[model samples]
Target: MWLPNKNEKKKSIASIANDFIGDGEAIFCDSSTTCMHLVPYLIKKQNLIIITNGLHIATSLSERSDAKIYICGGHIYNSSGSVLGSSASEFISNFRADIAFISCEGISKNGIYMSNDEQAQIKEKIITQARETILLCDSSKVNKESYYKLCGYNNIDTIITDKKPEKNSFLVNTDIELLYPVE
Candidate 1:
């Protein structure tokens, strides 16, 4: 399928962040690069609380107003600047949030998967605790697979992408909601 330029897609997807998130709500944000795009949008909301293992997301939002930032304690990875491990998962599972914005390496009929298992554990744990679980991905990622299956398509409440998905039974028969930027 033909796709938009990478920069445009990133901007479109980043803007949708505010639509899924709300003011005064607490959310769990995954450590994916896509999550960083959301921090700017979230900074504008009032009384927003953010919980994550992403060092970048934590520090960037720290100086912002009307928000609380919580970083999961665990072994911090140098490469991605994300903290992960059993300790991280345990820490994340302790608090409940309003929503979780997670980005994965790929997604297929089997499930949404991630590149790292440790980050996947934290995401899955947050999925259980948060009232809403929203998957942030681009159309290029659809029908692809990753190393760890974080959750099945049915598990998430909605998926916000830069483009709308083609008609498929996995999306048609299930309760999953799909969102995209307006033309």
Candidate 2:
């Protein structure tokens, strides 16, 4: 697994929130640690509602007064601290949002990819159901492929990362907007 360094992960997620989301937009954010870092920014918006599936998000958003949180029911993936399964996929398929912020274990020129099959299916559903999809990842994940393909590069509206893509050859032709942290 290509795990991002702490600062890189935070920068990646913050860039995703700044670029794809607008004021008053309801967004569905995955319960990944990277996604959690972006939650404070989303909560600052008076009209943003966050729909998520993990207990961590619920606890994190509990003290926030500006954002409203909704939990989705599903089986938990203990290793990742995420919810996934058929029921989770169905719930994701039925739910629609202005944007969905997703984080994957890996991604390649071929497509958005994931490490787990059930989580991959849920990610695919989120991509289909949301009007716009923003992928949050770090430099380490770029150009690195995974087993299961969630969707192709065309499916995502934007990709946010901490490192500059110029250093990674494969990121050149994808046509996805790339966001880097401000120095």
Q: Each model's TM-score?
A: 0.89, 0.87
Q: Which portions of model 1 miss their true places by more than 4 Å?
A: 1-6, 168-173
lDDT leader: 1
Q: For residues 67-131, could you state the per-residue lDDT of candidate 2 as single tens digits? A: 77776778888855678778777776767899988888887767778877887777787788888
Model 1 Cα lDDT, one tens digit per residue, 61-175: 8866568888989898777878999999988878899999888888887888887887788888889989998888887888889778888876799888888666663544556
Of candidate 1, the 10-residue stretch with the lowest lDDT total is: 1-10
What is the Å distance of residue 105 in model 1 from its true position?
0.7
Model 2, backbone clash pairs (residues 3+ apart or across chains), number: 0
Off by over 4 Å in 2: 1-8
TM-score, cand. 2 vs. native: 0.87
